[model samples]
Target: MSEPNEALRRLLRESGWTLSQCARAVNRVGAEDGTPLRYDASGVHHWLGGTIPRGQVPRFIVEAFSRRLSRTVTCAEAGFEPQSGQPSQQTDIVDELIELGRYDMDPSRRGVLGATLFSVTLTVPDWPNVAGRLVAVESGRAHRIGVREVDAVRAMTEELSRLDDQFGGRHARPMAAAFLVNTVGSHLRADASEPVRKSLFSATADLLYLTGFMAVDEGLHGAAQQYYLKALEYAGAAEDHLTYCTTLRGMSLQAVDLGHAKRAERLADAAAAAAPAAGPRMRAFLAGQQAHSYAATGSKHQALTYIREAEVAMEKAEARAKAFGSYAPSSLAYHVSQVKYALGDKVGAIESLKESDRLRHSHYRRSSVRYNSLLAERQFELGHLEEACSTWERVLDDYPLVSSGSADRKIQHMKSLLRPHLRNPTAAHVYQRAQDQAESA
Candidate 1:
């Protein structure tokens, strides 16, 4: 292997990932099409030094290198021959879709795909701030779909929604995000008329937004920010105000998560202004997000005021029209309750949480809220260490087999915060047990 390629290979191994793991990332494309590519360790070793593999396999090679490195990598970075110099190739977009699919699913893979020699040839500009204009849309027209047949982007969006609800964001986000970058992105690149393309654009925007959502769930806040921005641009292009509003709300939520209270508030306010026609549910969700921002800033009065507004919005949403399918109106109670807790209104927070839990469907995947963990925190705060420990243990057992990033971190954070409160003998015993489980995991 040449120097650059050898260095690349060594880096991959040192990262605690196997060659097969890298190969599997690329195989995401092959698995979808039933024509998996095979790469041996030796093959990887050779490719690193500047040997380009034959056929569409190069795309996978780039993807694998990127995932392990946690950065965008190109075929050239891995010492592969430039994509343009390939001897022969198929123009079918499906093959390209496969390549994209592999890249988007994993951040490391995305870095590689982004750096691939052939990327510039793809010619789609960096995803815009919001989708372009959406003047006319011919929904369900075969002429617009052309030879490159598809199941319609909306179908894919619905699939993502179902997965999110059933499996939780942690379990299902990566694949959903990949589907957008690969399949949906492919359709957007196809040669369709303006109207047909507008519909396609809107669908693509939704997928991108969902992809960002998944990224946030996975603890990739920076990547999630970029995806949300791209989705916003696409949404603007689609001339879909609702989608744009939703994207803005997503951005605000992310800001809140990162502790940027003021920015979150501004974004939420902007969303509320832009989405006048948005259903009550959408409006309520935005308001609740704003409430979170206020609470994070320690403005108890403002937070309470926004919470009331959110409640009003939710009631109006439930009574006015129920077609706001993307987000549930009733979730306001849950969010407001959380803000209250953050502001030290423990009693109010617990009450709101109970209401939210009742209204929340089992499929809503509210694992991030960790109400039980919060309950434990409240118990500890009230001088009930034994009850807190018992509560935490129950939560640990509830999802024993699951290894969700959000859940695990929440547990760790809880344990860290309660360390100082372990003076009670029974509490100390429980804390020691929790500590053992955490360390073993």
Candidate 2:
């Protein structure tokens, strides 16, 4: 009873139209327009199982159904809720957005969105093709200044990153986005030298990437995907290899989160190839990303291979050089552990995470949030009911908004693991306490 299917059923029920009737209507209209659309009751049934329709088919479906019922159609109305549950098998706005983000990360992956219909899930109203056609925009004409202003823009970008680290990205993302669009964007259009212009674009792209990532963390996925695409364009123009690699990694991460493991792996591989001369830290980051992709695809051997590669790369990275915005060894290890956990190697994941913590003395607030969830997972897997509950309690206290994908998934898994233990009074007490703390927090 997925929303899309339910919505289709409701439309049929209200309109008193058979599934074949709706399908015929869509096909007829599409044929007239030289666009083919095909669907039936079986299709509707599949959509109910969370299948996403693709290309103009979704719009065709909406229009056909709307015409029949004398009402409007929306993705949400059709039960294609974005980010509320498992991704639909049919392509929708979510699929387009994620694909757009991935495409932006690795420009080599770019293609007509329509062609990806069968491969993608769900339909999105605003596709990436629309974004690609948009020209570079300079909304703030008066903000234009000379090369001297470039330094100011770079500084502002760094300051924003600092703020994001201190306060969560959610709190700082809007301000950062505004600065990129208003300030750094203006600099890009200013009368600056080629070098200064390139620098400005890179800075702007980084800011945009940060904003998009923060939005992703906040579950504003479609919006995040759009932002990532824009950031990728800026990075391409700047020819900044590192920023480009990071942007692609961001896209890969989003794809993996959406369960598009194959796409994620392709993106990560492209990122590594793009930055062949990447520093140790950079290589480590890309390798770790590949590891995640492998794990998600259920390729245990590949996951471990990339994880080990990341470790080797990090070892060769200079400590001082790492200060200049490189992902540390510990950070890479943390990523590796995430992959292991995804592959259900709980013991291996826990050991890797513990080792990562030991090496990477500094903890990212964002990472700490993920780590706490992971620790609870490890405890749950080990059958330490009370310990798992206590671990979750600590996580709740540390990061209250633990309802995002990573945290929510961990909680769901742990709950399933603790179901049998719930009958025990002691275990139940701890679990309830943890749940209450999590809910209230």
Expressed as tens digits, the lDDT of each residue in 1-441 for candidate 1 is 434466457657655667666656566544422346666666655665656667757656655455445456665655555566221233543343344445557767654333322111111122243445442322333233532334456776777766654454665666775676556655655558666666666666677777667666555554565566566666787786777788778877877765557667877787777777767777777788888888888888888888888888777765533122344543676687779788887878766765765676655544423666766777677776777777777666644444455566667777686778678676677668767776776
Local distance difference test values of all predictions, in order: 0.62, 0.63
Clashes of each: 20, 16
Worst ten-residue run, lDDT, model 1? 118-127
Residue 269 in model 2: shift from native, Å?
Answer: 0.5
TM-score of each model, in listed order = 0.64, 0.65
Which candidate comes out best when scored by TM-score? 2
Name the weakest run of 10 consecutive residues (lDDT summed) in model 2: 111-120
Q: How accurate is candidate 1 locally (lDDT)?
A: 0.62
lDDT of 2 by residue, 311-420 (tens): 89888876643222468767787887888788887888878777765665433555565676677778777876677677666655555542344455455555666667
